[model samples]
Target: MVGNRSCRIAASAGLFVVLAGTAGCGDEPATQIAAGSGTTTTSGAHWQRLPDAPLSPRASSVMVSSGTEVLVIGGQDTAPCPPGADCAPGRITRDGAALDLTTRTWRTIAPAPRPLLGEQAVVIDGVVHVLAQNHGPDGYDKPARLLSYDVATDQWREAAAPANSIGAALTSSGAKLLAYETSHEQGLVPDRILDGGTWRDLPRDPLAPSFDRVMVAVGDERLILFAHELVTNPGADKPSIVQAAEYDLAKQTWRRLPDSEIIGGWYWSHTDGLLVDPSIGGADGGQTGNYGRVYPEGGIFDPRARQWRPLPALPAEPSDDLWQGPATGGPELAIVRGFVLDPGAGKDGRWIRLPQPVRGAAEDPAAAWVGDRLVAFGGTVHTDRKSAFTADTWMWQQ
Candidate 1:
């Protein structure tokens, strides 16, 4: 959790924006972006709409950047099933394509040589790096290997494999792409994979914990990773984030940032950093130098105050028609489990809400901030089978 002082800073009038990119989260798939005053309220905010991406629905695919283009990669497309009917098998994307924000075009490129899910990607020193599983048993219980994609030449090559199965969640921070694996070694000890191919021991979390989550770059060198503990069976209380933490690559340290302090309440599923729309506070904003702030659904986390303030309650659960079909699962489906925070305004970090919502998106869907848009590709969602995978891609711009 943020220190009491940081909470105070966040509670005060600091700038923030809610950024997301996805659609069809459920039946009533509507995207809304509102501009508001310093006071956080729906009415006080203004909504603006933008064009949407032209990609088929998919989940668990990789979304990352190669300099200017936002690349949407491999994911499964499983649709067309009646309510309560089992979903069809999942599909894997063989290649990738980039969306040029400058000209507003989609250019499809070479497909991934090995089609697989539960992998992660990042760009370091201009090289597109991927850590993913192979098409064999090694994928079942072992660590994934590393692969690098050269955006300039459009080529893929094998790098180093991690010591353990590189879990589905991965992010780039400082000079490394942090890879987290929560499974046990030999079903006994806990371990972590970092920088794509390195391994280290992670402290056992006493609270609800799982490696299937995401860590996003916040300020210049800081990242806040959201980790969740999901229950196989839902009860009176739903599953939620048992713990949250912030990492400073420069200092190479881990510090806990509680959801309550950063989000006012518990951030249900995901989080992101947004540059406060200057319109909110203008020059009257809380802090001066830093305009970016983190907002997690269920509430907003004020880094200046190091505190959290709740946002308006999410739209009431959509109707059953929007809820039924392959997307529906247990009653627990009403609760949100995935989201994206985008820097739509770009350079100045003018953050806006991307009006797309993927139903039951994986907490760690491959996401990237390319130019002025944020793209989310492939993620797991609730299926008739209780939990199914998706290969859908969604994009939003400020």
Candidate 2:
């Protein structure tokens, strides 16, 4: 069982107010706020706290928005490991919840068929497709199942399973769902395209093995695939590389672009453009992981030019804690970490840091564009000794 000390503090008013004596599980207070009743912002963007999600604190949770309703899917609610024991499975959760963006309210939804952790979800034609792992009595080993949830009906049904057990990436082009899986036999990644609810293998050139990749629909006819080199042997020195390619659905062929100067990093795609946060290089000449540094610099990839342009660095924050990027989709706004960067504004785009609702180090919080606002939901927070999942929800608007 997890310790109570790691339990999330329940906010009475649907807002997380930082109390004088109260602190997060971290060394410092979870949030930094000045005395005020109004929301705070550094760049004119406003932050508003929403009702707490009914589900427990979780990380690696998948969230997708269909119209005005946002669905929070299964994630790991980790507990402190017992002394000398390993935390492999770490209390994976099967519960699911939904947040109504218009009313800022939450309601419990049907739970997943099984506990799911580290799964990927995508919304297509108002349905959420969840690619889950198949877990044995021991732990997740292979691609287990594909589940679909209809937002209007609030019901789930099984979809056609992929060919491989491990899902690499999932995205949708218009009404078609494209799922990528790792081929254990050929040591390559293959594409599984969904047609009329069934999955069909798409013919493609052999690609290198990559567990971390991003697929974004450039248009109705082209899908851009960004592949990254993974460090198979953790702690081993490896060079950072990012490859870009575009797949023509009509011609059924892939075209590789010039190698990107940007290293493997997080990507945020909007109707206007794509933003990439490159891995930061440390003093040891090593690339820092996503959580390692607050990389002040980022770049915007122009698909038309097939080139990347530099984006100005973000303003310094009190903590060097890193933020993951391009969370929400909007033509004028971009969210990195918890801050909103408006590149469409004045001469150079400006970065506005928003106040945190649940502090500590939020890792991999799922965010979606809801109407005019961006809703950020559940992520993990790391303390000195232990880590806790969070069910807090916050919204940002200009």
Candidate 3:
């Protein structure tokens, strides 16, 4: 998550922040929250613990949909060590398992053919697909492959790898899966889409090389590109030049969206037409943990309407660990701080805060919608020697 303090104050106008305790702008919910981070909701939206995961504790794994179950795939495990304990041997593993949401059980699937350090996964044609990855500091230079898991056959296979996949990303739209690297060679790599079983080049993105850029799938036929264009030449001294653009898939042309006027980073994720910066306040607070955190702030880009709404400042949070994604079970997007309802998704625009995961915080955890219950598991926290690995399973009821 990354951000800047400069935000348009009127971003949340006319939108209701439907939390229990306070109303930032619009009408408040009738249910009076009893505090404790809104952990217990009168509306039956609460957090609960599931059985401990059978899969090994890990982070940065591929968690994607597989028929009626949620599949957990390859990730690296860094065991939290004792104070000053040796932890130079943490390794990435290809192990995987499938969690049958109907029965809430796990069965080990065939391990990936290569190590799994991927952050994105999608299922195409009933097969689970993920990008293969390299590890440590040298991962940027090492070539990466594509891995697919055949659930029915319980087998794994490798495909042509993405060149310079360290900063690559994967997202699915309609029936097509896309892969692209944020940084390649001089600037960026041509965006690729999976056709049949092979990666095919799409059109070249229109933006010039920038310090940072990210693409987010808006809907079935549109992709939104957000970036910080690096300005050169004389008199180009502005601190920030945040940009947003849209690519119409049918026409295959890049059109510029309104300038967000905010610094951008890896924190952007979109769902249901809204691109959200999940965490903002503590992003640059300090070099240490989030003890320097302030209230949350981020920009929300609604490309469909050519609008940008600044996220309303929420109450002070203890930490700034937010995992944002589509709440496939409902019209809302889930962030650890709370859930955001998309006004266009048959619900009123609202923000609902919830309790932090009682379990220790882990970065890059895997979460997916299993019906109305959101299942999340497997992420790690390295305190002293990059040690603690979380095997705990947590679920949220929508």
Highest TM-score among the candidates is held by which one?
3
lDDT of 1 by residue, 208-306 (tens): 344334455665576665544434321113223224577666766677776541222222222334311111111112243222544332334445455
lDDT of 3 by residue, 310-358 (tens): 6544433423222333222222453433443332333223445444445
lDDT of 3 at 117: 66
Residue 324 CA displacement from its true place in model 3, Å: 11
Over 4 Å off, model 3? 1-43, 81-89, 136-138, 184-186, 196-198, 232-241, 282-297, 316-331, 336-348, 359-364, 369-372, 380-387
Q: What is the lDDT of candidate 3?
A: 0.57
* TM-score for each of the candidates: 0.54, 0.72, 0.73
**Worst lDDT window (10 residues) for model 2?**
3-12
Higher-scoring candidate on TM-score, 1 or 3:
3
1 versus 2: better lDDT goes to: 2
Give the whole-model CA lDDT for all candidates, comma-separated.
0.43, 0.57, 0.57
Per-model root-mean-square deviation over C-alphas: 12.0, 9.1, 8.4
Name the weakest run of 10 consecutive residues (lDDT summed) in model 1: 325-334
The clash count for each model shown is 47, 1, 3
lDDT over C-alpha atoms for residue 225 of model 3: 77
